[model samples]
Target: MTIPALEQIHRHASVRHYTPEPVSDDLLERIVRAAQAASTSSNLQSWSVVAVRNEATRQHLAELCGGQRHVAAAPLFLAFCADRARLDRACQLAGLSQDASTLESFLVSALDAVIAAQNAALAAESLGLGICYIGGIRNRPLEVIDLLKLPAKVFPIVGMTIGWPARPLRQRPRLPLHSVLHHETYHPIRDEDLLAYDQTMRATGIYKDPEKGWLARSAQRVQNPERPHLAEAIRQQGFALK
Candidate 1:
């Protein structure tokens, strides 16, 4: 049976255009509270969010985020960061040795940030606000870190833009259920499944050229090798990744 929450989840679409109206601080707090309610690893809650409302900062961030104008146009932009600095401080206060510099530490913090961001996104959507995740921020991690004044053990995981939608948005198509949901032991992806999904994507007309389907687009994206310096950047930010 379809519930209201399920309906909302299924209706989700990335909103690139937004109205000029600003999101009230009271409402933004509530949305963030909802995000804090998301499950965290070992209750560590190793994540932080920076709310960017300043016009100039947003404009600079938009430029850093691969020139996405929607980022600057949005009423609010949130930078979700994977943070272990707080935990390290806590450990030091207790006179204990802290070593949150490993790869596992980075992974856990990133996962926590991602989960919290999704919670915030859903909450915003429920309140009739539009939201878009900005992974493009990773393209210039060092710049973002400097702009935000992030600490040694904290790094940007992703960014989000939120505001009231200027117009209706069409839901994007997803991969077939069989391809994602595997039963028993891991099932190998069938070629037919990919071909069928590619055809479905072409039919949906999300792409301008129907000939350029999911497979081609996804392959092109991976082959482009964007953000090659990301790993080195993270290491410089104090993540051992070992």
Candidate 2:
């Protein structure tokens, strides 16, 4: 029986281990088409996705993602790029001035790419395929642009790994509703709510580390040396997020 949509969404966990079964081109095409069908900013559709299937390319991308083996082992790897070059070219070809230089336009394309990538990720999960986002893809943005042959005004926002999951998984727990949800006005979260959430997460058994609390894990991530220098990396990749 198919699981409920809300349950599936809330139960999602980043799957790192995958089976040997390969994802077929036809299935991958459908996922891409579904991703394109997602809503876009002013219908500019300023995003591009590259599916990396070759072992060598995947290995290189895996290294870019801090040597995450799943990026190299997954049957399908997708790099989602925020692209303004197409619209700029179209404007120039039509003898019109392109307004793609603004920070707003850059943000729009970045948001659009993220939305499209999530659409594809959810669709793949719904089909029993496991997927994980490779945020480390941004660690070396200029190198990724060179590896992918991306044009000017195009930036790789993130990468994804997709394939059949190899093992039974535990669902990642989330913060309590009160911690995230608010009434019409944004209500400031209370200290009690934060403590309650930490306790709830501790009980979930999803996070195996002995940290025992959400705050500790979050703090560790913030202090992690492996985290990329995101702003400078994006700037180097031609995104002037001014």
Candidate 3:
């Protein structure tokens, strides 16, 4: 019963290795247009994307993104930003006061950015392009902002690298349906479900050690003390987040 679109979705894998072939300007524009076609909260469309094609800029950004080489190697890198600057300007032009400093406003803008990015990613994948989300950009938000020349009321949500794949990648294993799907009310995940998912992940052989499964790896990531200072960075970027 799986449709072609669903099959593509299920086959998605993060592509870190890319070929030297460049993505054409027209294709990049089309992909971005598809992103703009995504649903926006209240039709405000409070998001912006900065396309980085320069090798020097991409290298600097790659370093800022915790030395992720794929960012520098990709044909194109896009920085999706949760933007309120345009809305604020619109309010000013209408002789109205702007109040986009609240936490709710920030959340809405960030959500819009995420939705747009997904749409763009799907469009790229449909066109036989590869994409990888680079969340490490958040590790040095101020540096990214300075490098991109982002104004106040605009905060980078995430960065994505897109290009032609160097080689095919296998789909990563995911948790079972029952572990995440809850009908009517929230249900606590059973330990057995987690163990089963861990086994599946181990069997995939992606990790160096099969014994260190998804649960342990995920828990380690969650407990990592080297988390990004996103809240402080957001505050500095003029988001009150109240």
| 7-69 per-residue lDDT for model 3 (tens digits) | 778778999999989999999999999999999999999999999999999999999999999
Note the residue pairs that clash in candidate 3: none
Q: What local lDDT score does residue 59 receive in model 3, on the 0 to 100 scale?
A: 96
Better of 1 and 2 by lDDT: 1
Work out how many backbone clashes candidate 3 has: 0
TM-score of 3: 0.96
Using TM-score, rank the candidates from best to worst.
Answer: 3, 1, 2
Q: Each candidate's lDDT (Cα)?
A: 0.93, 0.86, 0.92
Q: TM-score for model 1?
A: 0.96
**TM-score, each model?**
0.96, 0.91, 0.96
Worst 10 residues of 2 by lDDT: 224-233
Which whole-number lDDT from 0 to 100 does residue 87 have in model 1? 91
Q: Is candidate 1 or candidate 2 better by TM-score?
A: 1
lDDT of 3: 0.92
Which parts of model 3 have CA positions greater than 4 angstroms off? 1-3, 225-228
